[model samples]
Target: MDNYKFILSGGGTGGHIYPAIAIANELKKRYPNAEFLFVGAKDRMEMEKVPEAGYKIEGLWITGLQRKLTLKNLMFPFKLISSLLRARKIVSQFKPNAVIGTGGFASGPLLKIASGRKVPCLLQEQNSYAGVTNKLLKDAVAKICVAYDGMEKFFPAHKIVKTGNPVREDLIALTGNKKEALSFFELQENKQTLVVLGGSLGARRINKLIEKKIGFFKEAGLQIIWQCGKLYFEEYKKYNSDTVKVMAFINKMNYAYASADVIISRAGAGSVSELSIVGKPVVFIPSPNVAEDHQTKNAMALVNNNAAILVKEKDLDADFDTVFSGLIASKEKQEEISKNIKNMALPNATKDIVDQIEILLKK
Candidate 1:
């Protein structure tokens, strides 16, 4: 078991990729000599991120199918065939004791082939709504590790384990202090700080909403730390001032979480898991563009518990001002939301996930 070899596959976004990486890190901790090979789609963020996290990764020629007819859609069959062949080759050669998939386009072919070859497989589904890839591979995987309740609607009840999403280690415990965090972001200690996160690529609607609300935020006696994402940084950086900090990305999220009085964020599963652990009052703006509108479902899971607030995209113009103002004005509301959200945090999620993987490997 000490020399166990494992293949981890999941990618396309930070939501899927980070959970896979977190699981691998935990497995590495348990078995120091274990070998891990990550498989992801070519040119996806995981190709860069997995290696940066100190793991060897291979990329398959694959991409998700488009909704409308297009050249890429026509190429889907060929890409899937090529990816399956490559995945089979990897599995046969690596002979992994267990294959873990976190759910993405890349994981479909890899997990399909590994499970077909009789290798034990486990899946981690991060969203409240299951991804297409996870659902397709549900029967093939021995166990499905899920973060939210009611996943049996998408996955088999017997195959499901209610282990929350694995968050990045840095976010699990913010070691930085408020004073240093304030200094790091160059914000005034007297002003209440609001942090805006639009995921890695930024959200167009959210960015526009923030742009229009700058004066509103200033009037509310709040300072801002806005992560506009790399694609939109240049367009929004002009708004940066002493009270409003703007950046393409945040390298030190621990400090950002530490300095925040309130947070406005996209409802990605990874963000939800991290925010729960951070235990801050948050307002979620779920992106409507994703498959199955999973973001909305992810937000509703917390909003139902009164652990967070949700302002839909269509209602942002009308609801955001009133909702934000009401929340900010009430210290009692903030503390109540913060405490409730913290109650939902699964601090030992990574460890719990790895324990399931161990069961599969032993079988």
Candidate 2:
């Protein structure tokens, strides 16, 4: 009679979608017979990603409220009402023992309705700075799972659990094999390697800076592993040479993290969490395009602690050359950054989050 049902909701970007899937996967591992359903925004990335993760998903006609004046903002009320009704229906039909939301556009409505119906809901907040949606639903959520410290500024202090983020299991597995990783990338055992990632979609500023500074990397004699993302792949692929490996998507992220002597990346919450676990010297370039500038706050949490370096997007073009070159040339600085950031790793976050769910479900 194992009929424990769980509904997991999150979407809009890989940042939100992946964490929800990681939690769902953890639940599956612990409760093999549990039925799981995902709720995400219609026409969003989650519609495709959730199915790919081997779960059933229902989409709501939900969108984020516009920040600027537009016709879309005029339709906001109708979409909100429709989505709330749809979410309530899904919650009633699923009859979930417990529901989980990783913050996103769909999560606000889905968790709100589930909480209104007396279903226990868990909110996973990934950033150091909480988003408006998560902040609005904080009181309605049964418990809050967070990656950063001092989130009491946003959530009820008693309900907060510092469970770090649940990253891809593969990235955690990278901790063991450094030598195997260098060989896998066909990198020389002794040379310093630098890994540059602009996320899966790529950051325009980071890509442009790297594209224009190829000779600097060559002059420094540093080996490069660049993940330029899908958007700028074609334009940047020509920069690939014997010393530099360029890719649109890196299927084997564990190898990339393990092989790197240093990493330059955008400071998305997920990337920050994974980088912390990988324990590499990292330079963060937080994207200016994100809502509330949460990415900068996410990186600053670490930078303030001397765990990593930050290069503002606008400053990357002018300042990155000297800063990057100096860091790569200093082994002491690299080791110090690596050791400091590794202190932030939460390797057991998946287990902790699942444990929280189990505790709430049993109650």
Clashing pairs in 2: none
lDDT of 1 by residue, 1-363 (tens): 499999999999988898999899899999999999999999999999999999999999999989899999999999999999999899989999999999889999999999999999999999999989999999998999999999989999999999899987887766879999999998889989999999878899999999999999999999999999999999999999999999999999999999999999999898999999999999999999989999999999999999999999999988999999999999999999999999999988999999999988777
Which regions of candidate 2 deviate over 4 angstroms? Answer: none
The deviation in Å at residue 81 for candidate 1 is: 1.8
lDDT of 1: 0.94
TM-scores, one per candidate: 0.97, 0.97
Worst 10 residues of 2 by lDDT: 170-179
The per-prediction CA RMSD against the true structure, in angstroms, equals: 1.2, 1.3
How many angstroms is residue 185 displaced in model 2 relative to the true structure, after the best TM-score fit? 3.1
Cα lDDT listed for each candidate: 0.94, 0.90
- Model 1: pairs clashing at backbone N, Cα or C within 3 Å: none
Task: Quote the lDDT for 317 in model 2.
Answer: 69
lDDT tens per residue, model 2, 310-358: 9998887678888887798788998888899999899899899999999
Model 2 TM-score on a 0 to 1 scale: 0.97
